[model samples]
Target: MKKVSRGQRKQTKRFSLHSNSFKQVVKELSKTLVSGLVVAVASNFLLQFFQNQFNFEVAWLFMTEWHIELFILGIGVLMMLYIWFTSLIGNRYIGAFLIILISIILGISTQQKMLLREEPMYPSDFSMITNLPFLVKMMSNTIFLIVLILLIAISVSIFWLIKRARKGKKEKKSQHQKEVRGLRIGLFVLSSLSLIYIYAFNSPGNLVKAAYNDHAYWIPYSQEMNYYNNGFVGGFLYNLNVTPMEKPEKYSTEKMNQLLLKYEEKAKKINETRSKSLKDTNVIYVMSESFSDPTKLIDVKVSKDPMPILRQRMEKNKSGEILSEGYGGGTANIEFEALTGLSMEPFASNLSTPYTQIPSLMNHFPSAVSYFKDAGYSATAIHPYNTSMYKRKQVYQELGFDTFLDEKTMTYADTLEESPYISDHSAYQEVLLKLEETDETDFVHLVTMQNHMPYTDFYPETTFTAEGTADDLEAANYFQGLSYSDKALNQFLEELTTQEEKSIVVFWGDHLPSFYGEEVVTVNGKVAMHQTPLLIFSSEKEKQESLGTISPIYFMNHVLELANSPVSPYYAFLMTLEANLPAFEKGMYIETGEQESKLEREELSSETQQLLEEYDLLQYDITIGNRHAETANFFSSK
Candidate 1:
């Protein structure tokens, strides 16, 4: 080879330096891109899995405009930020570990909320969660691991390719410039495509940058026209196929009032049939959490009967599955039903709490309180938790209670239960003490919280067996809490029976215990709504009147009639497709009477939905202030 000229040698050295710098920059870029891609892929896959697994679509359908948008944006933003930060802080192994841990915690929390966030008796799909169990769990873990490894490898290889490309830079300068421009264009195109997607599919009414989301049948249409339509905007898309397929149900006010009147008559007839004079019977309503029908011998059984004390009283009391208007949670909604006796519409997102939203009804509480006051019963309400948690203090006082006692005043300083908390047993004791302390014969409402969630490690005084069969330590703890409450109740009743004053204890559960955290169990190819027991226990000497299988809405009315309180009128909707010519179950309504009208759960038969919907109205206002008064009395008399 000829000796290289000085100029050529200098040019080659310069080229080499430039090539090395380019390689370094490209390597760094490749690593950053790879990390981001891995995070995005993993997050999207996990999100899709969870959404499909839990029927989040139905939830989105039910959510209010604000909630829908808030939830989507909140979840998406939080998740993206978490992944983005994690990628910046750690290597693949650490990131993977964090992802798994966070996913599990998130899964549990979401599962709890999902389980409780629907109409009661929504059928579950046990097959999906239970089919292969250990295998599925193991496979999922493996898949994630494999994907993580593949991503790391891809990222490293891309970095190496950049190094090789840089070595050939001098000869390929013109070609390299062309490739760089093409890559930049491709990235821009991809970003534009993503923007189009977000705009098209995002829930309407939410500002894009302010960020929020929902889904109707129109999702496909919205997605297709995202470049222009931007979703439903004040009837601009009314002609679009994306509009809700289910038409807005319309009922004439006259027709609704007439229907309500009919139900009122039916309620009167129920009281007549029971023959338990509701005239002046003191009512005790006990709303237990996760108080399932399993406590009874007639239904399922736990290894050890958690609610033994209550079980003993079940035979004598007029009780059965109250067929709750809610499933895993929505305690307030159920409380609304027990109080108002109104039919709950499925499509109505504004049905959470009538007392909070419907001011007209809320404003009437003073009248209810005064009405009982005139009838010689002072109204008081008691809750075994922070009174302010649910705004119960203001609401209770507004509803006419002479006094409102919450966890703070009701719990004694020396109680075994501990600060910021009181057990159901302790709550019952407080109730009794209040009744004894009060000079007036009064109506009391009690809300208990000892049986509330994270049920496993919550009780300081009680230790659950962490061993076999009781895998449901959480549920077991909940029931144990309930049992303790029952024991307190039994003792209280014994004392009340000795008193000369006659009273009727109208106690029922506020809502079923939240089984949202429990793993879904499939028995005999069917999904079951864990049953809850509602009882109208009495200490008065009137003939023991027992009405069979009545809805919770009827429980108050039945008691009111027995005590001779004049009841407000109501109507039943009973339009479910399962029943022929719209049938009423007991004294309740069915917005959809058809068999398939189940609480949007597809696992159960359609007829089940009809039966479930019949009692759905108890989630609404039907019986005015009777429940509030009754609940107050139950707490005071405890």
Candidate 2:
């Protein structure tokens, strides 16, 4: 071989260096170009889907609006960049390839989510659509479209990769192209600048503050397209599940002293005349589902006894028409009302239970577990359904229960048929078992579900005694369910009486059963929902007159009185309402008596709106979390 010259050797070295550098540049360019395009396509598809699904104002509405979508896109972009960085670090093209694969999977998942009935991709609810027969057919079409798009994306990604590799090989001998390189860098910078601009100036409030401080600041974006998506943030997420302190400024202890004195005098009179030593009692609260007194029920003739058991309980036990605050159906609201003696009427609207929308109220309750627990009772709760159904597990535990038994650990004599719910008799069996197990020092809280319906359908034939009108039949079906529940109670009572020591069994229906169809409207009056059967049955049947006649809120005070437990100071009771609603009578009585005090103290007293908002915030805190409750703090200073 001929010996090479020094200049030739130097030229060879330069060529080798240039070749390697060019290859590296080409590889990075190819990876970014391919990955960026894939992400943009996926993002654009999401944008287009949202636009068709919702009327968004921005061009890339998915990225600009809908916080969830934005989060997804942000995560996608970050992943893509991460892939690009990793590729550079490892000196291999694997990062870009992995990103492309993940993008396709995510894109498919997003599209699939839109088609599912459970929480559609868009904020706009398609839940009503699920009721439609055509929904399944429509979803099939969506599936086909998503599948096609995914295939196309995959094919395009593969084609682009192959094209880049081919081009890189062909340009192996060429000098690095400076103009093309500059253009790529310029495009990257422009894209980044656009993202920042859109994020900053596109919405309301201080963007920086929302980004850093607002717990649900993303909500504005989440609902940028669908306005109804803007629900109470204090609900189910931010508010601490505590009862709110009533607006302290509204009523003063000095003003409330007048009422406290009256109560003191009344207690003195009752104590001086009435016997202070009360018998150990079993207070059975029968809570009928969706129960309301229908004027038509009084008029109509039916074949069966709808409320035979309840009627029997009412006649035999101390019963009254307890005015409940709800319509159609909201069980937890009534439960909250009954347990805390907090009237839900002041806060009632589309916003039903604080558990779902407000968690703050969980802690702000004017009455609490301590009240019952302090009264020489170990409170045990039983529900024959999923423990977490409606978040009951947490709510009940937080409210103060020594033992909470749901469907998970519940015993059943008969298997549940048709639905996941247990039979009424089986539920009662569990109640009886609990009653047997509890020490004499414990109290039982039972939430029954057998009466939940398809109204006429769920009523057991044996419980139904063919007797009144169609209204009677409805009542009868309710009674039949109640009768079955009553049988369970009778068994529980019989067992309880045999015990050497006594315990209180407080069993009440969560709400009246909700009837569907137009026929229901024709029968029940508009306000029929408020009329529910509230029966308090004690183990030892004393003259019924001894049972207190009062609202649910007052039940707490009375429970304290019955068990002879210590009552909170009147000031603490007043302050507690700051977080929860006191009964209508109590709130009104206080407001009425403090009229002069209210006029004297404007800033010190809570306005009607402020009280309602505070209550709402408290409810939100219990169900949601603390962040949501703080939103209502806007009114705190005012």
lDDT of each: 0.46, 0.46
Model 2: what TM-score?
0.51
CA deviation > 4 Å runs, candidate 2: 1-288, 291-301, 346-351, 358-368, 413-420, 455-483, 503-507, 516-523, 545-551, 557-638
| Candidate 1 per-residue lDDT over residues 273-314, each given as its tens digit | 443333344555567655564434222345565566666676
CA RMSD of each candidate after superposition: 12.8, 11.7
Q: Write the per-residue lDDT of candidate 2 for residues 504-524, one digit (tens) a residue.
A: 444444444433223553455
- In terms of lDDT, the poorest run of 10 residues in model 1 is 119-128
Error of 1 at 366 (Å): 11
Q: Give the TM-score of candidate 1.
A: 0.54
Error of 2 at 339 (Å): 1.5
Error of 1 at 525 (Å): 8.6
